[model samples]
Target: MELTANRSTCIGSGQCVFTDPDAFDQDDDGIVLVLRPQPSAGDELARATEAVQICPSRSLVLSEQSA
Candidate 1:
């Protein structure tokens, strides 16, 4: 899976960080930072997707890998 984030619109909620520590983190300004943009492992993919789905600001986005 592929992960995408709108850094400009992040709310610093930390939901993505809490959901997937390996795939997400907080920057100096507390914006949601994408650590792993493409997660392939089972658990990693699940957590990344979960973060995307649960983002209240809808700044996190997920997409299927392109062929």
Candidate 2:
């Protein structure tokens, strides 16, 4: 799966960082950053989904890989 963040919709909330520090981080301004553009399955996917749910700004998004 692939994770993406909408720069326009982001509001410097660190929820994504809180959920998965390995998968997500924050800029100097505290905006969410995806450490892994293409995540492997298992724990990574779980963390990604958690980040998406916890994001107050709803900036995090998950997209399935195309066949």
Candidate 3:
């Protein structure tokens, strides 16, 4: 899966981080930083999807890999 976050839409609420700290983190300014852009591993994919679903700002987006 491919994951992307729109910084402009992120408010640094940390919901994504709360869902998966390994996949998401906060910058010095408290903005969200996506650690994994395209997660190929199963565990990473799950965490990335969770982060996307839990983001209150709808900043995180998860897309399936296209053939």
Candidate 4:
């Protein structure tokens, strides 16, 4: 799976960072940053999905990586 962040829409809630610190982080301005653009299966994928879902600003996108 691929995890992407849209800093423009971030609200700095830190939910994504809180949800999965290994997969996400916040910049100095608290905008969402994707630490792991492509998460591996199992726990990593689960956490990525959770992070995407919990982003209040909908700034995260978890999608199937295109071929």
* Full-model lDDT, candidate 4: 0.87
**On residues 1-67, what C-alpha lDDT tens digit does candidate 2 reach at each position?**
8899997789987878888889888788877778997778898888889888888888888998777
Q: Whole-model Cα lDDT per candidate?
A: 0.89, 0.85, 0.84, 0.87
What digit string (tens of lDDT, one per residue) describes model 1 on residues 1-67?
7799999999999999999888889989999889899998798888987898899999998888787
Among these predictions, the greatest lDDT belongs to: 1
lDDT of 1 at 64: 80
Task: Quote the lDDT for 37 in model 2.
Answer: 72
Alpha carbon lDDT of residue 17, candidate 4? 82
Per-model TM-score versus the true fold = 0.89, 0.88, 0.83, 0.94
Worst 10-residue stretch by lDDT in candidate 3? 36-45
What CA RMSD would you report for each candidate?
1.2, 1.2, 1.7, 0.7
Residue pair clashes in candidate 2: none
Q: Indicate the residue-level lDDT of 67 in model 3.
A: 75
Which stretches of model 2 miss by more than 4 angstroms?
A: none
Candidate 1 lands at a TM-score of 0.89
Cα RMSD of predicted structure 2: 1.2
lDDT of 4 by residue, 19-56 (tens): 88887888899888898999999999999888887789
Q: What digit string (tens of lDDT, one per residue) describes model 3 on residues 1-39?
A: 778889988998998888888778899988899887788
Global lDDT of model 1: 0.89
Q: Candidate 3: global Cα-lDDT? A: 0.84
- Model 1 misses residue 47 by how many Å? 0.5
